[model samples]
Target: MKRDLGRGGIVVHPYRGYGSRQEVFVMGRVFRQAALGRAIPHHGVLRDVADVVRRIARHGVAGVRVEASLGANRTTATTDRDGFFDIHLPLQTPLPQGLSWHQAELQVSQGDDRMHCHAEVYIPPPETDLLVISDIDDTVMYTGVADRLRMLYRLFVQKAHQRTAFPGVAALYRALHVGADGEARRPILYVSRGPWSIYEMLEAFFQLNCIPVGPILFLREWGLSWRRPWPRRAEDHKHDLITRMLTMMEDLPCVLIGDSGQHDPEVYTRIVKEHPGRVKAIYIRRVDRRPDRERAIERLREEIAHSDCELVLAADSAAMAAHAHAKGLIAQHDLVEVHQACVDEG
Candidate 1:
């Protein structure tokens, strides 16, 4: 299929390498106007089915009641209930090959109006089977500016409007979650000491940073000596969350990325020992000065020494890439090499 995108241009979605009888699906939502000013409710938007029509223009046919792009030779079904469209073309169907490219366009005709959106779909590259579990606070994000006072302020008094993923974080995570070929996998779970009250703020930060979304588990404020909602202690709260996530991904090999600023090393070491095959590698980012942090990391490493996972300290994304490459987790050219790749993408 070919589409006249614009002046002196065309587009196409080639059907190659896809197995016969397989469903070709393109999924997303469409919204409609409601009142005069307010945005349409996300959940209330109705789904509209789009028909895919393919045609080939010949000298004999002039305007023979054409239905859609190409020339109206075939018809596909409407989108799903979620406003998603699926085009299923069988292997028996003969494809056009003379053009420089194949074009696929979305055709939606409702009431008396007609809309056409064209796209060129190409097969994506392969992705690696690697999981990247990261810590919050000073590790994946920045919260070290004000120390405990700042932390307390952000938790209790003020909202976390300033939270952001560190440099290269978004790019690195996006690459891990979605492969270079554009196939997105289950993102690495976030185990943080952050409270759940700022869920909206944290969610917004993820969006602003273009970080891949993941299930976030937070800790309570039990350690503050006040506002203790849960009976379990603070350390126990974090430890339990980490254990559960580690267990959840037990079948998949994962990398533990965190900083030496907190109890990540300790918690990760325990998880490695408990679930020997789960952890593939551990990368600890260097943080602010803490003389005792080294001893703590050493002890944690000693505890997990029996595990097959290797632990290293990375000063930047390059170092992390080195570790990932050595372990055959990701390609050396992956986004991990870009320092602060997340911010770089922006």
Candidate 2:
């Protein structure tokens, strides 16, 4: 079920078979606070409105409550009439070594049909020294939302309702989170520009596709409608977020993975510039063939010219594996590594 946790969030219970296995979506105030009196009308579409209402009805009056076992330890509000709640947890919470894993429990009380859901929040261990910043649209999946033409067509006419993943991106994502040994570990962070509406969709897509779970930070919509186009100055917001995250983990090195479709090159380029010494490398997927996009492409090249961050463009997951092996990102023996490491550990 999906619900708006008022401050600008869309909480998503992304998977089934909970307990020690699943994770829930928890958004931040950057979006929630901004969305306060600025939500666009639902267009009063009966189907869409009904869907939201049904989801809310599933939660009932008790609604949902989230308790993050990290940082200062905070909880969230109950579901509103619009089916929304907001919980603002600090990015870093000082927990004991064994308690590094954050957990959220949802108790839905709608009369006799009550439900209790819980998922482990994959908080990075204190010893974690690796960071993974990723691109959403194509690098993660085959959404192909970066292209203005397809985006226009889908946003206007087709609506391209279903979201799908690229062939092996999920497996690669799993490897990145779990390393050689299989354990419920951390050191992974997913950064994207996808708006609030699809928060649950993105989480569901990743879980269904076998991608490992991680903290997903996305854009705030900033009062824009769902059909609003990507803004011209949007990359700066990502750049700022990256900088803050990097600064928090300044002691560790980060690996940035993105697609050649949008502002990733530019955002990451600025990140490398601001914290050149902290960036380990960068990997970009080749998705578009426009020469005009060369300006953004050049930005990555410019960063590579002066820093230790290696930037490579892959045609697909296979190409990414080959290139990663060649560059020593992972061992050659693990080249065939498929699925998330947690499965192996289980």
Candidate 3:
């Protein structure tokens, strides 16, 4: 029950994980907390550098043994060099009907004490019409991810509640979670290219902004951890993760959301091609205003033409929400909430 192994100087950062019909993945990091919190750097030059140093310093014990059990299934995983452990277990029977997620126990042995905690693993019900997987950077909040200085400033200075979700994203995401009939209660997975160091902060951000939380999946551990795949870090990350979901939940369709500032267009295009009719929609927020970027996304429409997926390049959340409303992907009444949420700065 003690997730933060304070006495043992170890903390397990287990995310609200997700799964399909019979398979559930529960992932978390068991890192060593720094003896004391690092000071916020004063100069701009030190801000970004200091943050990375702090993250790796706090990134705890690697190769630790982990024990996780889901229902009758139990599995063990060793933390990688980055102190991250991802365990996959399969359930023989489907979770109870009408349930969106299930809680499973995970135990980590550190020295004399065996610390443990329960982490939520989402299991989409049979009624789910679509599964939503969204990115968190420029897509969810204004982190200024492309700008290194601004991104470091936001990451170090801003608290989760202080962070803001892109206009109308909360309402738009909520509508998708509830589905078109206003009661389907689908699953929404939040993923990012960033490391697991910000997991707690991201969780608080989701809770504060009212975005439905399913699983927080990340592709790599970022700069400090050179172990991440080189060159293609963002590439095929969304495609690969979604493929796993699609493989497990064969009957359900999927909707992808990300910003044009990154490789979302290309990654999503690959998913649409590889999965065929499983993708319902792809919403890429147009954060990049360059003429070349606009034309680039336009070409993706041609790529996914034959598939049921429609890649919509929109400038704002309102545009995507409008499209979803017109298509009855989200309840019509939810449009007002979407419009209102977009303008709500708080």
Best by TM-score: 3
Q: Model 1, 200: alpha-carbon shift in Å?
A: 0.1
The whole-model C-alpha lDDT of candidate 1 against the native structure comes to: 0.51
**Global CA lDDT computed for model 2:** 0.56
Top-lDDT structure, candidate number: 3
Candidate 3 shows a clash count of: 3
Model 3 steric clash pairs: 31-60, 32-60, 168-342
Q: What digit string (tens of lDDT, one per residue) describes model 2 on residues 1-346?
A: 4445333333444222111111223532111122222354444455444434332223212254433333355455455433344443453434445654555555444435444555455646655546777877677766666576775333223222355566677667666665544442545666655544445656766676667776676654433334753444475787877776666554677788888887777777777787857877677888887877755686568756877776676666766666655655555445675323223422
What TM-score, computed on C-alpha atoms, does each candidate reach?
A: 0.55, 0.66, 0.88
lDDT at position 131, candidate 3: 82
**What TM-score would you give candidate 1 relative to the actual structure?**
0.55
lDDT tens digits by residue: candidate 3, 1-346: 2443223367777777778766888888887764333454454655645544555467557878889887777889999887878888877855677677678888888778687888888887777788888888889887877887777667655668778788888889989889788888888877787666777678889888888877888886664536742224456667788788788778688889999998988988888898788888999998899999899899988988877789999878888998888878987789778877767743
Judge candidate 2 at residue 39 and give its lDDT.
50
- Candidate 1, residue 79: the lDDT equals 35
lDDT of 1 by residue, 17-76 (tens): 111111222221121212222232323222100000011111111111112233233445
Query: Candidate 1 at 253: error in angstroms?
Result: 2.2
Which portions of model 2 show Cα errors greater than 4 Å? 1-94, 104-120, 146-161, 180-184, 225-233, 292-299, 338-346
Count clashing pairs, candidate 1. Answer: 11
> Residue 254 of model 1: what lDDT?
75
lDDT ranking from best candidate downward = 3, 2, 1
